[model samples]
Each structure stands twice: as structure tokens, then as C-alpha cells.
Target: MPHTDVQMDTHDIALETPPADVFMAPSICKSDLLAGKSYSHFSPIPAHISDDMTTECVLGVDEAGRGPVLGPMVYALYYLPMELQQSLLADTHHFDDSKVLTPEVRSSLMRKLCTDGSDLHRASGWATRLLSARDISAHMLQPAQYNLNAQAMDATIDLIKEVLAKGVNVKEIYIDTIGRPEVYQKKLERIWPTIRITVAKKADSLYPVVSAASVCAKVTRDAALDVCYEPYQDTAVNEDKATEASTHVAWGSGYPSDARTSTWLKQNIDPVFGWGNECRFSWGTAKELLEGKTADVKVDWPVEDDANGDMRMTDFFAAKTEAGGDELVDWFGKRVTEEMEDF
Candidate 1:
């Protein structure tokens, strides 16, 4: 009887259909498989796969909204089959760190990747809840960094458990380093002993799996922002409240160093709401507000200068009065001297 053999490729396992004569008795290999001819021929697979039968699933984890002044921390997990890794990498060639991609490009890529059917499993979790500026101010809460780090880990672990429940065989977990890579890995190991955790700097940019996780996390957070904006718009219009307007206003970046965001914070200082309804009170912007600092005091707009280079309030009035001193007095039915008397 002729020997039978099986071959596998990166994308799939190719099983050769046996010949008709094999119906009586199939030839089977009784000797141990040679290293070069068996699984050892290919590079070692990710640890997530054990005994060739278990499906190899890579769990990519990433967090979003870490730098935002408002909104909860969002962590997402993406479980993708190891076989599809190469194809996914090719499809998302433009994929890099989510921070590096423009919002428009990120949105376009996200729509394309999410629709593809490749046995992908995903889960996301938000922080306990968005800490309001009022709560922070009243309780004298810790800095934003403390709150953010705490929430990030909380969301991450919760999402991991969710993916596990969905029957995803998560063998290895990759997380983009948040505070310190080594420290985070140690912490994560304590929570999940069975899983191998790799925390690396800019892992999302370096790994396709991590980048896919990032895209999903960002899309989910952005959707939450849309929901947050809806209630804010309703409050601004129906309540006839300008203070509420600042809450919903998309102040550029919403960071303390941002002039527009700082100015908005200063303009709408509410003891109850702190800087603004949406402003994260634990941030430096809220700290400045609590210290009674004003954004307008930071810098002043340039004033126009007259011909003599002296700063003038109205260039039009000065230029026009000099050109038509007599005509201006006649039109107003008043003498130039009479008008200048008050000045």
C-alpha cells in the first residue's frame, strides 16, 4: 500500500483525500514522525495552542481614552485565530499605533476590519464610572493619574474575563504598557495565572493583533462619546443654560495646556460642577480653577497701532477723523472741536 501523508499551510490544513482502494485498509504510519517532517519543521506556535487539536487563539488587549480629560477608560480584547495572522497583517498594512493614525483614517480602517469574518471574538469594559469634577472637588480626590491607572487595570481585567466566558482560548495576552512594562506584567500575572502576559512599549504599533484591539477599543469609546453628547445637547437647549453649553462644547483636546479648553474652564467655573459639567476635575485644568487662576490672564490679543505706532483702540475712527475732520463734523451737525471737547 502507498504511504499517506498530510500537509498544512499558514492559512489552512490540507487533507489529501484517500484513494478508492484505501476503503479496504488504509496505510498508517507506525513509526515516530521525524522532527523535520512533523510540527517541528515550522516555527514554534504561540503557547496558546497545546496538543495540535486545541484552536490557537491570540488575545490582543488595548486601552483607549487614557489621555482624555473626560470619559471612562475603555479596554478591549480581540481573540483571533493564529492561522489568520498573516492575512490580517497584510490587510492592515496601514495599521500602526492608533495615536499615529488620523481620526478619519482610523474610522475608515475600523469599519473595514470589524466586518471581516475570521472567527474574531471581542469584549470591552469601561471604568467603574466617569468621576465627576464635583465629586473630585468635594472629596478632595487624588490626581487624575491615580484615578486613570486604577481604572485602566480594572477595565482590562474585566474585559479579559468576558472574552474567556465567550469560549475564546486565550493562550497569550498582549497589553500596551501603561505605567511600567515590567510592573504591569507582574500585576496582570497575579490576576491571571494561566495566561502568559506580554507588556511592551507601543505594542499596538509593533503587533498587528494589538493594533486590531486598539481599533475596536477606540470605536467603542467614540460611540460612548456620541451617547454622552446626546444627553448634553438636550440639556443645553431645553434648559436655556449657557453654562451647560460649555459642558457640551468640544473644547479642543480638553487638556490644561490647551488655551481654548482652559479658557472654557475659566469662563464656566461652577463650584458644584467644578470647571465645567464635563471637565475631569482631577485634571490640572480643575486644579487651576480651584486656585482661582484665569485663562484670560495668561495672554492678551494684539492691539492695533496708529501711524505713530502707538497702540490705538479704533484705527478706523482715528484714520477717518484725520481724512475728513470737517465732513465728519458737518454730517453729525457738530464741530470737531465740540466733539473733541469731551475727549
Candidate 2:
């Protein structure tokens, strides 16, 4: 029998390099490099290359509104093939965790990802759909925390199911760790027993896929807020006169530390839309609402244009009141000058 031996190539393989014009060249001037090349001149490594190992399609998962005093918990999933991922990495060297980018840059990247070759899926648990704030308020903070966590987990599972239904082949999933790493891993494992899941402390910073998902989730949630806020802008302005004028700021990271958001909550807590039912009464803002310390303001409803070329007046009160506090000031604060009670 002839001895068979396999030989490995010792010489370095010549990798194909594109022509100078065809290849992407850094925008730095030669003079700048000669003076002293800064870190910006360094080329970024493509996301598709994962620690010298090429990975199959990877699904990135992220959530938003985790600490918000209002609104629902939003979860998003992004899937990218190795080739397209590398292409995106090569084209846009600035791609990184969404938290590191400014709002304008994040918005731009979000639009690019949605239009570019990436599959996106999102799911949410609106405050209305979950147990009412009143119900949660009936219990202590611990129970409320449990309920919110349950809601978030349910939303995440639903999002994963939606992505799977779309026929995307995802072998591995990466999540930005929420609570304790071990706890999050166990919780995710319990929720998604079939899939291989990894809970990274800062997956968004480490994994390009997770960063892309974060951008998607943040942008989608922001857009939703804009939709919810359109009708309320006029109301916000009107309320500002009676009470402290609200800054009417955009969603400020959904954290309790956001002052404008806290002020908005303080202004809106009342009977028609009290802390427990209307807002996330479980938050500290809700406690403040119950204490009656924040500003008291009400949003104004728009006048309806009827077919008879007249505005609909449901009652005498509607006919008498204006956008300003004229009626309220007269009725509540100051006594009526004349006895018009009979009307």
C-alpha cells in the first residue's frame, strides 16, 4: 500500500485586493497623516468577523422603555447575514452602540438599517394592555416589579416568535443583559428553551448586530411617541399658561431622572386620568401625583366641525368656555359678578 500524506501550504496566500479607486479609502488628507495620524484614521473591523470565527446568521435583540414612567416596553429583533453585515461595517465605520450616538446620528442610522438589507421585527406591551396602574397600585412595589418583568418577558418571547415566523434562519441570539447576568440568562433560557441565547453585559457595544437592534428599537419607540404626542401638543401648550410651562421634551431616555417627563406626569394626574389608570402609577411620578405636589393642568379638546358648517356644542358649558382659563377663573376662583345660575 502506498503511503498517503497530506501537505499544508507554508507560503502566504495572496488575498485579492481591490484597485485603489475601487477600494474604500479613508477621507483623511495625506498631510494630516504626516503630521500625526489620529485614532479616526484607523479602519474599523467589520462586524461579520467575530473573533476570527465566521458566524452564521445571528439575531440581535434589545428592549426600550424599561425604566420609563409611562408607555409600553418595546422589544426589537434584527437579523443580518454575514456578507451584508460585513458590507455595512465596511461602508459605515461609525456604526456602534446606539447609546453612544447622538439623536440625529442614531436617527440617520435607523433609517439606513430599515432601508438597507436587514430584516427587522418589533413587539410591545402597552401600559393599557397590562394590568391597569390602579390594579398595580393596590399592591406593593415588589408585586408591581414582578408584573412588569413578566410583561417584558412576554413581549420578548412574542417578538422572537414573530421573527421566526418570517422564515429567517437565526442560529444564535444576543441580548443586552438587563438585571444580573446569571438571572437574566436563566430567565431567558426558561422563556426560550429551544434557542441558544447569550446575555452579554454590554452586547450592544460588543456586537454590531445588537447595536443595530438597539438603534431600531430606539427609533421605533421614538416614532410611536411622536404619533401619541401630535394631538397632545396643543393641550400641552394650553396647560402651560395655567401651570408651569412644560418644556414638552421628547422621550428623555424613559428614566425617572428626566425632569421634564416627571413634570409632565405631575401636571396630568387627576380624576379623568389619574396616576393609577392613565400613567405608569407604579413609578415615583405616580406617588408624586397622589401627593398633589405637581402642577395641575388639563388638556383642551379640539372643536369638531360638523356638516352644518358649525362647531358642535355638546352643552352650555362648551358654548361658554374658551381655550384660556376665562371660564374656570370666573367659576372656580372668583365669584360670578351677576347671578346667571338660572340659565
Top candidate, metric lDDT: 1
Using all chains and alpha carbons, the TM-scores for the candidates as numbered come to 0.55, 0.54
Residue range 197-299, candidate 1, lDDT tens digits: 8999888987777876676555544544333333334344445543543243344333344454456556666654453334455555455555445423343
lDDT (10s digit) by residue, model 2, range 1-343 = 1111112121200001111121112222333222221111111222333233334567677765455554433466666664555445424545567666655666666554434233221111111012222333333355334555555556566666665554445567787866676777787788668778888878888776777777665554444333333334554345555754433434333344555455665565564466423245556555555544443544568998766565555544544556554564466654465446645
Residue 287 of model 1, lDDT score: 56
Worst 10 residues of 1 by lDDT: 34-43
State each candidate's clash count. 0, 0
lDDT of each: 0.49, 0.48
Taking every candidate in turn, the Cα RMSD to the unseen true structure, in Å, is 26.1, 22.9
> Candidate 2, which ten residues in sequence have the lowest lDDT sum?
12-21
Backbone clashes (count) for model 1: 0
Please give the TM-score that candidate 2 achieves against the real structure: 0.54
Off by over 4 Å in 2: 1-56, 86-93, 116-146, 187-195, 235-254, 275-278, 291-343
